[model samples]
Target: MTKHTGAWSGTVAKKSRAAFDGSNLYRRLAVRLDDGTTIDVEVGRALWRELEVGDRLVQDEGGTPHRGQSSTA
Candidate 1:
């Protein structure tokens, strides 16, 4: 896993699940950042289930990932 700090906001490019050990899985989002860079951020299952491709997402400083402007609730 990579260490992501500061604030990052982006559009959801895609969703995926990764398996390392046979017994565990991790959900992730391939986000296209506002600056045009793509990043894969791991997320909780519940939240992962709630998002879709093209959805706008933002993670403010010291906050959790959530819907952003132009995204429907």
Candidate 2:
């Protein structure tokens, strides 16, 4: 598998229900990258709860996503 490293900033454009595995629901986020390209990221229910449409997201190269602070000053 290809590993992505470093931090990337983007906006959560949309979300969708990915799968239901017995107890947990897997969710996918469509993030619009800073450059205008979009990427689909699958995350667990816990992480999914923290994300919302239009929220700024910071994803580490390790594929971990976090809620990012606003860039507007």
Candidate 3:
């Protein structure tokens, strides 16, 4: 996979967590970007808690994913 350059903006498709060793203890917030191409991004627990499906997500080059102006808003 190549490093993402510039910026990418899209809607949050879904939220998920990884389960390891049959234990959900290793849980982490994950989301699949619904841009033209699918991309998986790890989001912080704090931010994740505030995110909901369909929210706008934007990340710039060498930047972090953040909640953008929601279309619904």
Identify the runs in model 3 with alpha carbons over 4 angstroms from their true place: 1-6, 21-35
TM-score of each: 0.86, 0.76, 0.68
Clashes of each: 0, 1, 0
Top candidate, metric lDDT = 1
Q: Which tens-of-lDDT digit does each residue in 1-73 have in candidate 3? A: 2445568888777777665567643323333455466666777777788888878788888898888886663
Pick the winner on TM-score between candidates 2 and 3.
Answer: 2
**lDDT value for candidate 2?**
0.80
Local accuracy by lDDT, each model:
0.87, 0.80, 0.68
The number of residue pairs in model 2 that clash at the backbone is 1
lDDT of 1: 0.87
> Which candidate model has the greater lDDT, 2 or 3?
2
* lDDT of model 3, residue 2: 42
